[model samples]
Target: MCGMLGGLLLSAVLIEGKIYFSETFGEGWQQRWRLSTWKEGHAEKMGKWQTSAGKWYRDEVEDAGLQTAEIMKFYAISASFEPFSNEGKELIVQYQAKYEKDLACGGGYLKLGPSTEDLSKFGDSTKYNIMFGPDQCNAEKRTHLIFRYGGRNFLKKAELPYKQEGEGLSHLYTLHLKPDNTVRVLVDLDKIYEGSLKDDWEMLPPREIADPKDQKPSDWLDEEMMEDPADVKPPDWVESKMMVDPKAGKPEEWDDEEDGEWDAPKIENPNFKGPWLPRKIPNPDYKGTWKARIVPNPDFSDDPDLYKYSDIGYVGFDVWQVKGGTIFDNIIITDSLKEAEDMAQKWKALREVEDAAKKNEDEAQAKAFEKAKAARAARSKENKAGDTKNEKKDEL
Candidate 1:
């Protein structure tokens, strides 16, 4: 009911400020399923109605709609533990989940591996399997289809058809095992991503091989002997490679007129100025940010009101100062322009999620009231029938 009111197909439930994708679909949308947490006494309560540690969850919210790419996440919960003492040992990770109902309009993928702070360390070198289809897949020449893979790059992995009947789902997913074998990924099927599979999975590459000598093991192993890569440290090159180059764009340029020597020139407009831009409004269920800003009005010669500098003219002041003001908003403050855009997208998504959650709560309350009213009416009818039967029996 919250989903219907909020217009969310697959509404994510935020419990204690944490978001979770509900893995339930079909006619009976009363219950939700998700991974269990590993709290004290959770193992025994996992299968129980209220104490399941890592088993699927049953949410009280009803179906609103299907979720789109606006929701991205990384989560993995497994009861089985594999001890890892091998370094650079190759392993495959796989899991199977059944779709209860056929989704006519939905898209997403699944990935498994180590996790980084912002999905920066994911890669194809790790074994992985993903199946993204429809718009999410972003295939060159296909529509409404699925793409499968075992690597970060789709081009380097396998692709498969993801179409299924009403209750059909895919199986046989595979991912590489890293030295720090702990796995993290966005296993939700109703989300999309723009980056490679590793980014989509939100997994970090292994920091260190469990066994340094096992870094390039002779063979790949199945999931049976897998271990967690929690105690590993990233190799030297990984840290060095991941470092951000401070002088990335300030490369020295050779001036032909200066005898082919390299010299770094200062930027003309180092302090960028721009106007405040507005963002676009997505659907109620949308969960991405949108932003735009008006370009900053520079005190350049172009503005007739401001003192202008001509191409060949110079100011004739002996000891005068020239200064003006510039206004900009939603511009690059610390990160890149693209990162700012991404932040806007995330804000938009958060708004959508909040709106959806509010709507879902309202609908659930209404449904509860309706059910209570119906139950009360049925009880009243039964009471009247019993009164009549008692009177007839007394007369006999």
Candidate 2:
């Protein structure tokens, strides 16, 4: 079994594919990556990226990747590569990421865009061909795979499912856009979704739309039900909820000249009916709710190259993290599925070590918590005894 698995790994590594841009965040990474100056003028509001393997990892130096170093700040950075166009080729983007702390609200996504002179000016508004990654805030968990067409970014209409991989542990994301306009997303080696681009996103104009000149007729009876014309109030029906008691007598101490006249107390009328509502019956003349006429959209056009990005020269992370500790590494923009899988194998080996470390840390935290709890209980007991001793002295 071991020999067979090794052969498979060898085959994956040997599969031919083109790698456009890749980064492992090795030494001198600061020279390759440029941080944005969008928030530089502000006082201490900008977040910076640094290399790390975090508190626990498989190999400190080997696992080191660019991590957001500051808390409660925004981070923007990008690395440029030789400009290339994936007009007729398969495109695959893969990355390894870890939200070491406060994954409560932030994105671990990256974008591919064209090269620019001022990397310092790169910010959230920077236009890009594709934006793919994991984003989370509060209860929403999304794997964003957006395609930009005609200056508008379109997200997949169907939600891509996502799950958390615990704190301090790394996760892998792989997005593949095929030459056939099909796409697939994988998280931690698990295939999450696979479908066509045109079916999943609104990149082209809709086939049909509501007619602008059409209107519902004024005489249309849209109501499905109406009050029954035959239904009427019965002559014996009582409207009063409560009534004066007819059998009660005035008090014996009552004085007619000095006191006001005595009145009987009220009691719920047994014959009373609750607020009356007319019985509903189906309207014979009812036409269902009116709708405008549908017509073909004038702007409707289809393109076969929705999956293509004309130019991809830069890979960047433009993100705002309230409490940042997200580490992004092993980024690859390639054209081979096998190449991406081989990288995934690398992450698998690293994750096994990280998971074991996370388990040990969690257990240690639990044990420390128990010890603190016992000490607090002992102190409370001593305080109660001291209060009792003082009470006895006061009694003397």
- The top-ranked prediction according to lDDT is 2
C-alpha lDDT values of all predictions: 0.27, 0.83
lDDT of 1 at 239: 19
Across 180-294, the per-residue lDDT of candidate 2 in tens digits comes to: 7888777776778888988889888888999999988988999999999899988888889999987777889998788887778988899999777779999998999889999
Candidate 2 achieves a global lDDT of 0.83
Q: Quote model 1's TM-score.
A: 0.19
Off by over 4 Å in 2: 1-16, 210-220, 236-275, 290-295, 363-396
Poorest lDDT segment (10 consecutive residues) of candidate 2:
1-10
